[model samples]
Target chain A: MKIGAALCVLLLSVIAVHAAEIATADRKSGFEFMGRDTQAMQTDDTSNPGMLNVLDGGALWERPEGADKKACASCHGDASQRMKGVAARYPAFDATAGQVVDLGQRINLCRRDHQKAPELAYESRDLLALSAFVARQSRGQPIAIADDARSANALMQGRKLFNERMGQLNLSCAICHDDNWGQKLGGTSIPQGHPNGYPLYRLEWQAMGSLQRRLRNCMIGMRAEPFSYGSSEFIALELFLMQRAQGMAMESPAVRP
Target chain B: MPFKVEGDAIQRSLTGQPGDPTEGRRIVISRQTGLCLLCHSGPFPDERFQGTLAPSLAGAGTRWTLGQLRLRLVDGRRLNPDTIMPSYYVLDGVVRVAPSFAAKTILNAAQIEDVVAFLSTLRD
Candidate 1:
């Protein structure tokens, strides 16, 4: 009887070990999605047609939008200066709000406080262009989010969210994107969810948008409850993504698909 | 080039033309575009690198009817919605939003039809 019990315990332990191994293998790796890592090609060419949107975004930046008769240009003249390194600093901790905020929320707050304009909806083009222009300021700068107590706590939550499998497919983003990245899923190859060249023109979306919008889309694809626009979960995930692409340069107003 | 024969014929057949399986097999196995072998195993026994994700298509025809196979190609996720497999052909029901990916199917309707024809001929 004791022998049988011992064998049962051994078998259970083996199964547990096997399951853990699979789970560990399913997590996403930070480097697997880099364009340079996949194939050395000119991912960001100046001649690409997508650059036109950035120019349009620049125009919109100076256009007045609020009841206060103000524009983004009203307070921060030439974002090229005031917003330098702003993108790298985003998905940052907000002390008064006591939470993390995305670039969009910050813009909205600025619009409300200074320009007296109502907030734009999440994923709106004006917001996208404005954020893209702002992110452009930090071009080539490595993302530098602080790892203070608040951010550390946020990152841990984001990691749990990334690792946890919540979709109807019973697959985490880590499973295909992280584990099976180089491999094919369906007919298409799964690219890493890096934000290096965001506000990108994805052939799939056929438009320019933010990394937070992409994250929301992924959550929907996974059948999970997508975080509200500029939610802490979204900000935390953005922070995690920025850290993942820490050394990679920003590719705002990027093209995709 | 030879693989394209089956693909061309199958496309023609779907649009009402002739397709050759031998040529179709050649194209499906090639590296450039129809790298089907990267994800599925087939009768190309000499081809050593078989992907680990899905079951081999070598005798897939023997197990599943053509209609079932067609559905898998159309959108494997529909029958098994949890499937990571992307739909190769079927139109109509697709996510129509930000990025319009409707036209970028790896296999057009004709290509999928030709591949299916090639699979049918693999009953050895």
Candidate 2:
């Protein structure tokens, strides 16, 4: 009886440790924590314009749209391996450029440098589609941003963006999201501003969009002058939001009311 | 059985229109329009497990006088420095928001009274 009891206690301890290790695995992987299931990354097939871009992006990856004979597939191989877990770590500071770069900027960079393709317009359908395709490859990976000095500075700037008072509304993101969560602002329930699920399908937007676009919408809501597309401020904000949503699982392509 | 309670609660009518408490109940609970139940707990007949984010309004009428509640619904943060409550009645001159909703407040004056009336009915 004594031996059996001792064995049971030992087994329980082992199980507890194993559970904790699994929970923390994503932190080690350089991705934010995420659910085991990858389906959360799926966009609406018919309704979302982003989904349409996915089809176009997949084709773009395979087809040679550039002047060069080499397609993205020619070099990258199956995206499942070549591009796996790439998107979650983007908006990373590049030492070479001395600036933070998002997946979109990097894709454009690759096009210019390696593929010799003309750069796609910012926030254009081609860009959105390509981003969607690449982001899809990292469906189940946790979103992980580096936490070094550079990332810390970027996060600070992002937090300022979040807390800053702006626009004709005399409102800040903190007022609506932090102070007024669960409360009604206008007609809608102010949801906690978790960036866990992004590139989401918002009802008002009536399409799928990146978190940066959503941030722009929030600026419009506050009546603040929105930054131009592909701004450093936007990228820094993205890094901050992803870090805030650190432990939360990726709910990319989530449907919002 | 329903019994009339004397001056249970009263509020100033913005549009000089008396409000129906029953209609007010429907609006507060409705998910799309008012959605007050999402954050607040009251003597809502059907709702259970009220959200834990804010204080329950189950017996708010007993705690605050009708006039006090009226000011709160109009704009509560004026009383509390860090209130999350949105002003439901008073216009943007009191609390400015965006211009698109300039002519709008969450609830009209009538609706505020109606909600207050419904709140007063909760004795237990």
Candidate 3:
């Protein structure tokens, strides 16, 4: 009887441990949706349209700005080292602000506080470049945002936004990314919709853009009213996506169709 | 979106309702109105990027009656609540729907009839 009780406790602990971990939506990434030419666009640095933004961002990092006349390099010299693994852990809890902020928000905060510069307009070219530059530094690193009590509410809200159906189309993020991933939708493979490649270039956009931009486009496609950029809703949704895509390698500055 | 769900086969229009197949075809592909191509690949072989979530409409005329097609377009949930396909005409029974989009059907009565007409002509 003692042995059986001990074994039962061990098995229950094992189950609990397994339940605690989150899994990637699927094995395939959105990269699988591209054709050979598009794949070539990502693998070949010269051909990768996203490189344009990254290059532009590298310049921005060194250039001084605002009333404080401070450059990003002035404080965090050599982003390759100072900013390494930064993007992977974003949408992190900002205890000071008592809310979650994604990478974009973090950059904006830096600009506002240190540089004394106005916030970069969302989806602007300069913003996209900076975001791409920052995110690319973390490429190949697996995403692992903090999962703690403070983040519980934000994460749950994000999950609700993802799973809850809405709009004239009456669709949710899960319907495509989770329920029917890899299935064809509009002659295009429904991607897992991971944020690994945001601030990535797209053939359709012909320019670099952030994950929030992509999310807004999806909302329009669903025939729903999209929230403005920097809204708490977008932040919450980004937090959830980061969690959903945990362990997936970051692919910033990625090219997409 | 004004919609009524009845246990019996819902027929909002007659089988032989006057509908233009050409107009219906244009509507199905239009991003604003039909938007059907978002989840359904039809006989539009030339059109790029057709969706494949739902059944292909290659031979839809032979697969379903005009009444059946209209019902599906009007209120797909009534037939199958679990269907991911949106109800093009019916607006009620959906929660968390956008306020601006609320009380508005994706397609009007005539448009639904027109789509039914176009789909009927999809005989292989």
Candidate 4:
């Protein structure tokens, strides 16, 4: 009887360990939580409204601009070849800038440094198009944000922001996403808030948008003041989200409800 | 108007007069006003979709007294600091409020009274 009781306790502990592992390690794309129609829209390139932005982005990539008359294509050549797997490692620490930068900000840096052009406005058609164009090359690749010592502080800050309660709602991202995901909020099932399919189409917005736009919307919904575009806080949060989404398949220009 | 918090309950209504239960019901279900259904499910049969976050409001009236209900509606955090429910009538200690929502509570004094009146009608 004593041996049997010990065995039962051992089995229970094993089960508890397994549950904890699943909670921390199991990653589900927002795609899984979406409906069949939305899934179909995401899968079919021709049908996906986000593809329109991608197409426009493709055009923007080859068109020369700025004082130096340099298009992104001039330096990078074909995006399919040069930019593949690039988006997977972004929100990276840039030593020159002494800060972390997401893919959109990196593109702006390139335009300023190489193209000698003005920075594109946040959420502008041109910026979204360019980002979508670059990110499309990384579709189907696994997210693999690098572990750099330079970005350690930013990553820590990101993690803090994700767990911190904000606004009048006093709810953290972890409260809904980490704790209560798969539960319904009003009519909609709460998604895990993955960052994989960013620069994607959201039916609620009825337009293609960047991750910053979505973050801002959630803050507004929570009655919190949103961080400005290109803010360090937003970049840090992106770094944390990308790290959290590491190894999830990249699905840029994807669709969401 | 000043009110008093006695233990887990508020002994006085924010508004001097009693609120209409019908108006309270409307505010409770409204997407714009109360936003209660966003994180709470209730006994409304006609509402197709309700939240599954907080406890159901079906037995709320039977669960607590009117004063207790009033305190919760005003600010649940006074009891549970880590609650996800917004402090509908609190304007202090909130940070980074959006420009449009700055210096405003989720519900006004009369609105709080109305919501309390409506919630008080919820019996198991």
Best by DockQ: 4
Model 1, runs deviating above 4 Å: A1-47, A223-225, B1-124
Determine which window of 10 residues in candidate 3 chain A has minimal summed lDDT.
A15-24
Candidate 4, RMSD to the unseen true structure: 6.0
Candidate 4 lDDT, tens digit per residue, A1-257?
85775566567556533332114466789999999999999999999999999999999999998999999999999999999989889999887677889998899999899999999999999999999988999999999999999999999998889887788766677877876788788867998888998799999999999999999988888889999998988999999999998888999999999
In candidate 1, residue A145 scores what lDDT? 72
- Each prediction's RMSD over C-alphas, in Å, is 11.0, 12.3, 8.4, 6.0
Order the candidate numbers by lDDT, best to worst: 4, 3, 2, 1
User: All candidates' lDDT scores?
Assistant: 0.63, 0.64, 0.81, 0.87
Per-residue lDDT of model 2, residues B36-85, tens digit only: 76567766657653554467777776887766666677665445434445
- Where is the poorest 10-residue window by lDDT in model 1 chain A? A16-25
Residue B33 of model 4: what lDDT?
89
CAPRI verdict on model 4? Answer: acceptable
Report the CAPRI category for model 1. Answer: incorrect
Better of 1 and 2 by lDDT: 2
- Per-structure clash totals for the candidates: 19, 6, 6, 0
RMSD (Cα, Å) of model 2: 12.3
Alpha-carbon shift of residue B7 in model 3 (angstroms): 3.6
Misplaced by over 4 Å in model 4 are A1-24
| lDDT minimum window of 10 residues, candidate 2 chain A | A26-35
lDDT of 1 at A118: 86
